[model samples]
Target: MSSKSDAKQEREIKIVGFLCNWCSYGGADTAGVCRFRQPTDLRIIRIPCTGRIDPLMIVKSLIQGADGVLVSGCHPNDCHYAVGNFYARRRMEVLKRFLPYMGFQSDRFRYTWVSASEGQIWQQVVTDFSETIHRLGPNPGLHQTVDSAPAVSWF
Candidate 1:
């Protein structure tokens, strides 16, 4: 892609961020409290732990119109549950190896470790991730909007 085209496209990237409540989420909150100016294109979803992030959720986020997905959690051995981030790291490694060949690019999905005190890191991560996705152009997967019907009530 030409530099001119890339520059024009950078203004439209949409990102979905999945942050672990104990660490990354706190980091983001701190960023906010500190008045850090971060990109507004990302929609954040807080999960109890990064291990709770299902790979399908990544695919689903893309399908629902996010051009990129950022999964952030505690550093190795620093998870609130002690080992949850390790499991998350393993799952992300395996998924990273396969998701791109199926259409998603490395820029379309990313995983990172951010601790509660790393507010600047969290801001920078989101800023940089969004910029990369912007430069890569949009993902075709993001155009596939969800169409499933509501689940049956169990009352």
Candidate 2:
């Protein structure tokens, strides 16, 4: 690839990954140790558990101009915290459904399961999600609404 194309690709794609510390994060680490090829566009945030992740955090990231968001945690019934991922799944599902309603594309957000031992899975997930985000392109962000009057009065 030419330098100009490489620079354009780097600048155009940004993916934020929220990974559960006990499972998904370990999976990513294992993938790295195993020398699995992974996408460079992802920025990982290691959270204690998927249950601790608020949907608003993902939304905030999108609002701030992330092209996509990926949330990965322990497999169902395999959570180290014993059910954290279950709650996370439900919350993520709701968020996924709600994003389109709020004017964001539903495809921009994704949630999945990956165990600590599933390094290959982690690599695949990152690759696939990164590709999907690339197809979706840059997020335009939320639209601003017109207000009748300014909140603060300078006069």
Candidate 3:
């Protein structure tokens, strides 16, 4: 029974989290310091600010085989960098809406606000997102043919 449970854990989904240093990253750190139990599926990447995260970074992560992506930043009006997270919110919203047109599931990417003091919230957020991704299963990325280039050429 233990081995079966371990095997189930081994099949857990893979998720990438992009956390803003000033707030969300601190929240995650606080959660760790508080010994909050959180899922092991999310791998965190710390960035200076959510505003600095390019939409393409999330897209690239999904295309590269990440099962899901989560972006967390400071709450609006509480951002250390003033309105940076507001800009990030708008950009993330656009990306969430545009993902489906590009053949990706919008639910696979999510953005949220987490304050440095919100350790428990961070744990909950990670746990909920992990569960959601597990339900969605792995992202299939773009299915393409050797003879066919992407509809939108990067070059």
Candidate 4:
């Protein structure tokens, strides 16, 4: 019986979270302090600034079996670098366009602005993103069919 349930949950969506070191990370910490339970699917990675996020990183997450990606940072004009989030926002917009072209769904990536003081919003972001990904169904990346071919003798 436990095995069956485990099998059912084995393919659960993997939500990768990129959090800004100063604000969004603090917000997530606050959520924990308040006991705001979030989905277990999310795994957080802290970076110095949202601007440090690269399109390649997001692509690599998908390639590595992430069902979804969430990026959270300070709001406009609130970035520690003064314009980091704005730069991040523009980068995401362009990346979003290319991911779908690469066969990933648009909903697979999400971005938000969460400040250190917005603990509730941070909690809600995680909750809502989890639910949305749940509704969208499992990530197709997990279902990739590997081609098993016999090795040929090079000699």
Note the Cα lDDT for every prediction shown: 0.86, 0.89, 0.90, 0.87
Worst 10 residues of 4 by lDDT: 137-146
Model 2: colliding residue pairs: none
lDDT of 1 by residue, 103-152 (tens): 56766889999999888998899899988877767765543467885576
Model 2 per-residue lDDT tens digits across residues 49-147? 999999999999999999899999989999988988888888999999998886799899999999999999999999999988877667767668755
Off by over 4 Å in 3: 1-12, 146-155
Per-residue C-alpha lDDT of model 3 across residues 1-155, encoded as one tens digit per residue: 56545644666678999999999999999999999999999999999999998999999999998999999999999888999998999999999999999778899999999999999999999999998887776665566656766586688
Window of ten residues with lowest summed lDDT in model 2:
1-10
Q: Which order, best to worst by TM-score?
A: 2, 3, 4, 1
Estimated TM-score for each candidate: 0.82, 0.85, 0.85, 0.83
**Model 2 residue 152 lDDT score:** 65
TM-score-best of 1 and 3: 3
**lDDT winner, 3 or 4:** 3
Clashes of 1: 0
lDDT score, residue 143, model 3? Answer: 64
RMSD of each: 8.7, 6.6, 5.6, 6.5
lDDT of 4 by residue, 52-91 (tens): 9997898888878687899999998999999999999999
Highest lDDT: which candidate? 3
